[model samples]
Target: MSSFPDYYALLGVTQSATTEEIRQAYKKESLRTHPDRLTKASSAEKKRATEKFQAVADAYYVLSDPTRRSEYDVLYASQPRRSQDPNASSNFFSQFANMFAGAAGGSGAGAGQPGTPPAGQRPDAEGVFSDVFEELLRPEVERRVSWWAYLGAVCGAGVGFIIANIPGLMLGAVAGNRLGAIRDAKGKSVAAVFNQLGGNQKAEILRALAMKVLGSAF
Candidate 1:
């Protein structure tokens, strides 16, 4: 069963990001893990970088297209992901129609639908999420890491590479300490994330988590 990718999350941009912002973010992010940067990585790591690069590219594509972006917002944002069935990808038009029905009095929007939430008591955006998604799961967002992580890594790599340039005992130390630490940490984080998806349901959540992560990364 096919699942929709969370486009916004992939670009590390927000749903509210403008075209300019999206382009800037893609440009900035694409530079860091570019396959070329994986000069010292094993072939496997390079391949992984290549795939992530593609996901980033795909995110930029859909967001850059106005029509697709609108449809994506309507389908992805308007539709609640947790409908209980892991494999269910609801029909876009059907959800849109449901949204319309809700916009109207929701009395089945003129049918004898018993519960017409009163006009004055109209629910807020939060309620909108409740009505659309079964469980209304707000993404569990953790802290936004400081820019220092990237900066520090860049600084360390530069200093280490320069230090490793000088042959002899110092070079050996840089190779063992600096380069090794970076190699280990990058591999660990990357491996932890791309670890196999267990069951279908877990895969679905992980797929969703990937989007959320990709969004944050950008």
Candidate 2:
């Protein structure tokens, strides 16, 4: 459980570093600490380089965004953090696991009482999922290369699918758009049944719309 790294220190720059300086520092340090460059290093050294690389990425993400950068500039090296409490860590894990399991809809899980999950059980599904999501989604800890590769693959598939079913998709949209004309009780117009789907179905509908919208625009 490491505390947050100093964004300036991680980038090998002073707190007063300008945006250009920060960008240059990230380029330099990222090149040095990249995991690929450490492939020949010992296993421990490789892990250290990976952590360092992640820290540098995190720092750059924070400092590059104007809103977050302003916030960090104001708060950096100035705010006081609570002393690291070993007991708090264990207690937090206990509460977090039960809440997560309940949220995950697992059986036999209580709704997370304070100090619940015993000290012994391995890190629960909740904690691991949260950490993975945080690392993947946090502007400060992006998976730059991996994420772009995934986006490229998905966009490729989307294009292929749109080309294959253009006619059918257009028909569905025409039908959906006409849904507003139908009337229900008390002379009020009820949106066509298709518009009243639950969240999952609504997501499917929006995704279909997105493919069509993008296809036509392009």
Candidate 3:
């Protein structure tokens, strides 16, 4: 990889670009690099597209947040440009599959080590699900369990108790609460909620989504 990635350059923005400018750049880069746009291309081409797409996303994930952008600006100034590492391109898609595991509150394991998923294997969907919904929505959108969720959980637990006893009751409650939360969140503005979230929280969501998408592509 280039020494420290130039988040601004990656998104085709200047260091002084506003958050809106960075967001617009991200959308444009995402559209251009999204793997779906390369449907008819060779496997290699598609892989390259996916990597570029994820990189663009990574850049935005860092730049869009005020705190992260500030920290990145510090690093950006001190880090000198260097020649690209040929090996960096080989595993561009694998880092998220591994890095986010720990960063997003997962079982501890670094990239390329034991317990990490191989390139083509799917990352932990449960982890990604939790990161997207729980991390992104909890504080910014809503944290309390809604009436719908409570009702669903109660009903689900009752059904489970009738069908399978203690184990089913526990599983049903968890499933019911999840369904209820989804119902409550259906009308919330995700964009507005995202804007209210902190930098690390946003990074958790972005890395989770990136891992899921890139893992699927491979």
**Better-scoring candidate (TM-score), 1 or 3:** 3
lDDT of each: 0.42, 0.42, 0.54
lDDT of 2 by residue, 1-61 (tens): 2333366766778867887787667655655554443434788886776556555554655
TM-scores of the candidates in the order shown = 0.36, 0.36, 0.42
RMSD of each: 18.8, 17.5, 12.8
Predicted structure with the largest lDDT when compared to the true one: 3
Tens digit of per-residue lDDT, candidate 3, span 116-193: 244334333222223323433454335432667898899889988899999999899889988987876786555445
- Winner of 2 and 3 under lDDT: 3
Tell me the tens digit of each residue's lDDT in model 1 across 48-97: 76556545544444455464466557767654442312122222222332
TM-score of 1: 0.36
Clashes per prediction?
Answer: 4, 1, 0
Which residue pairs of candidate 1 clash?
9-214, 9-215, 12-215, 12-218
